[model samples]
Target chain A: MAVAAVRRLAATAPVPVFVARGGGTGLLPVELAFDARLRLVVSPRHATVLVAAGRFPGPLGVAVDRVHDQLPAPRGTLWWTADVDGDRPAALRDASVVTDADPVGSVVALHRDLCLGRIRSDAAVLADDPPNRFEGRGDHGQGGEGMMGGVPWGRPMAMTGDDRDGLALDRLPVVLGPFLPGFPNGLRVHAVLQGDVVQEAKLEVLDLGSGPRLDRLDPAAGGAQHDLRWLAEALRLAGLGALAVRAARLARAAPAPASRAALARLVRRSGLPAAWSGVGVIDGEDARARLVRRLDPSAPEGRSPGPSLERVAEVLVGQDWSDAVVTICSFDLPTDRAEAVIEAQA
Target chain B: MTAQAEVWAAPLLTAGVLAAGAYVVAVLDAAVAAAVSGAGIGRSVLAGPLRRAALLVVQQPSATERPDAASWALAPALYAGLAAAGLAVIPWSASFSVADVEAGIVLWGTVESLAIVAIFLHGWSANTHQSLLAAYRFLAAGLSYLLLSMFVLIAAAIPAESLQLSRIVESQHGLWNVVRQPLGLPLFAVVALGSSTWGPLNLADGDDLSGGTTADVSGRPRLVWSGARAAMLTSFSAMAATVFLGGWQGPVLPGPAWVVLKTLVVLAALVASGHLFARVRTERFVTVCWLVLLPLAFLDLVIAGVEAL
Candidate 1:
């Protein structure tokens, strides 16, 4: 009886959903953004429902399956694709498919069912095996040589390298996400990091299949709406979720000038400009400048398009991890056409 | 109350306050978030925490490719345990405290230091890049704030002439430390924010690193980690009240009531700061801590010492 009560109570909580946006997927679906019943989680581990919402071609399709397995038990996957009946990825064939213009109701219902054990949860697609062989010949599992030389668990251990401070420290090579939260969707950066600082970096954008985009459903949205949506994401990245939601709400509707002014005032009061000042400077303009520019609806439209994909690495080389993320997000990366134009080799 | 009853009630009180304070933090945070976002405020704010907890309880735990499972599990437990231990040293009323050790301030200091270890372990044990990066980032900045906390705490202890929290409260009977040393409470607020890793000082479990230390965590462990954060916020606020606002000293009502009321105010302030301020850049925060906050903390201590002399 206590378990039943818990299940019922859990069902009422907002469904933590991880949205896996394929290449060219613009801002979140307005329905998902507006619905309070759904929460977009940063990590797949924190989610119960994995919503694969775009065209996932090639390796990107495999990434969706990988993310699916990351979610803990009592989990489900929903494919929110345009061509529901036409063609679906083989991995997501058994998963629930939704082609509705507004799928918030479907997502909510699915979560309730998962919470109450109305359906069996999705199982892991990959086998529970290490991808690399543990080849350590040393007595202390240090591969063959010293402490930092080995592929212990299918991955090379961090090796010492020259750092910015003229000291030698262990440098760990990390490939940060096609699906990482707070990162641009489907863009991965191969970075060699010494401690929290990026030592060397390269950027790559995956060509997740291109199709009828989910977020561009309203093409009639003017430049104001585009700026507002970008402002919402920037706020979200700045750790201002409340302000982000308010910005998103404005983006979804025709806003009065008074509301926009009020939002600008709130933004100023929130100390965003002060906090972000001097962080991620590019061409004399910092993240703060980019954010301030977005707030002015009357500002001219021809903003400087940020660094191209190749230069992103140079921009990220010395930045702290968090600054690096904010720097990337601060750019106006025409996500819709980035893959086609900037296909640089990582 | 008899000595026997005092001994018995101490643990229960500490546990009860910790649990209740954590729940209150969640509710108050939700309310603040709603007000800021212009989201509708209603019964959902009150019920949101419990409902979320239930969801976590029912969900299964998740692990990375090769996580340090033991430390991952122990991290949250250790963090929450540290919170409870910190609360034990706080004097809720004149005649009541869990274990009012003679060196209670020293004990609280230990709690703040160990919190860094727990947070680092939580991030490192995950064996993921983002989590590990967060751990490294925290290690770099943790020491600066830790020193600031110690200096402010020592300043608060000066007027009392004893490290015992009860004596500190008693010392405040004549003049609260907040009034005597105006800089103490504001400086200590930094410690409370940093130690709990809340708001702008929350470099450890920030959204930038995809929840940072909590990125790969899920289910009950995630719930415990989050609860530990809230508990730390509460304990730090209670300590703030005890050291500065004169814990349990207000009149017209009972002693414990005053402590609770002051703690709630501090908690609300901390929560609001979390929402209002954008997270400081990690390097910038460290630079500010060392160059600015440290000197201010020293000045506070200097003022307290001169007053004592």
Candidate 2:
């Protein structure tokens, strides 16, 4: 029953959508497959069958980011035309877009929520996570408007697990944290493979930030330039329709090869079958991303479908898809290979 | 143009008041946090880079760090910059104007585009993931808002028949196009807010998902950017409110005063809506916009087209 419940949710839950950072320079699906450090959360609610994936927003942001930037940036991005992308810009004037968060509320009620809703009951005690910067909207006096005046920097922090525990974090409730500095918020999951088997399992929460904060699809695990570019488009969208989730259970998923050779290469380069961890739904961001590869049509699908594949054999064998609850798994996908497989399967 | 600009004191004054007021509150809010929160991780990020970085771990970035708050103020600041440029174009009593051109509409739009670049730059400078995320949201939002806003101008040009503000207003004398094209009023208003990146539509700045773009910003630039953006946002909203609502089209009251009153009310409504729904997630905001307002705006446009026919 629990499995069924999980399956139902897996089938029905919103899958976040991601746009692969495409350019003429082109992204290599193989390299992303080898990055063991990056993990992804898939989008299941978009019009297209694409995954809006986010990498692990974790402590080692600085180091991981260094590896990502090692790549030469791409240029000449693609454009969405009328109909291809939704709405003409003129359709946007006059009406200010608003959405239903709670069933309904009067202005006053909304005001109350703005101040107190979604807050932990003990918010006052939660290690005061600081009031959001109100656009330097604070009363900084006349001197507040100075520009180019060397804005001061804060001290570096240590995101150690033990240190985090020692802090007054207990006072606060858990909320979506930002992506580790290096990760992007909206990344596309390319491919998911273990040895030669294409088991359809998905990773759910690689949010660069938590679920609540997401609306528009972003390049998963994005950086400053990415944010600016994304927000520009977001401003145009009326609904904060978050990155749409694409299906991922037969439903079968980061960045680049670094100074540390890609994990896939670690095993491949070693001339060995990558040590297989029989895939069950395992947790941890990096662990999942370890083998997401660029599927070479030339390489072929897991026709053998493996011994571990038998684990779900009862579930897979001859059950009509009509009664079957197709669970969607999210991950980092390479554009070419993902397209090739869908086309072949379709 | 006089009809639209009567060059009222109200938009100027009201915009000033709104911007200054928001600015003051922002500043005070900062001092309050500083004093109340005491000297732990909050102070200035200057105290320690790691402390600042640690503070960034939580998705919800707040005003504890002065730079964070300053960065928070970026969108508004860009708004202010746009306002300064656009405001220069509004004709005061027709006799005097900052930049009266054959292409006033296009002109202001050009000026406004600069703000997007500013925003992108701000996000980059912040050097944080959430800030960058916010920047991307800003970029996506801008693409649509700019395109639609320009479209609204095209619709307005129907009756005016000219791009020049004076000519547009002159064309509207017999009966304001607003009565004929009521849909553009509110539709443009929505576009205006979206462009401004103000309240109800402020998902890009949300601390939860994107960590408020420009989260690590601080000091004087924060003030300028914050106040400037609010001024610009309110002014543009006021500008559109005046133009679409008939550019001082009310009864009895003088054109300028009436326009200001109308604009102020509209701005207040927009700001209040934002305050009311600021806490809603980005998706919810987007959904409400897509599900509700977009359709309504289209309906208005359809009705106008029928009237025009």
Local distance difference test values of all predictions, in order: 0.82, 0.36
Which candidate ranks first by DockQ, i.e. highest?
1
| lDDT by residue for model 2 (A1-346), tens | 5433332322221111122321110122111211111112111111111111222233223222322222111101111111122221221111122222211122222222222222221112113233332234224421223331112232222111222225321111111211221112322212222111222322222323222221222233222212222221221121211110001100002222231122223223321112111222323322113223211112223111112322333332222111111111111122112222333556
Model 1 spans with C-alpha error above 4 angstroms:
A85-87, A133-154, A217-220, A302-304, A337-346, B1-8
* DockQ for the candidates, in order: 0.75, 0.01
DockQ-derived CAPRI band for the predicted complex in model 2: incorrect
Worst 10 residues of 2 chain B by lDDT: B50-59
Worst 10 residues of 1 chain A by lDDT: A337-346
- Candidate 2 versus truth, CA RMSD in Å, comes to 23.4
Model 1, range B109-181, lDDT digits (tens) per residue? 9999999999999999989988888888888789888898888889988989999999999999968999998
Report lDDT (Cα) of residue B306, candidate 1: 99
Task: Give the per-residue Cα lDDT of candidate 1 at B219.
Answer: 91
Error of 2 at A297 (Å): 55
Interface RMSDs of all predictions? 1.1, 22.9
C-alpha RMSD (angstroms) for model 1: 3.1
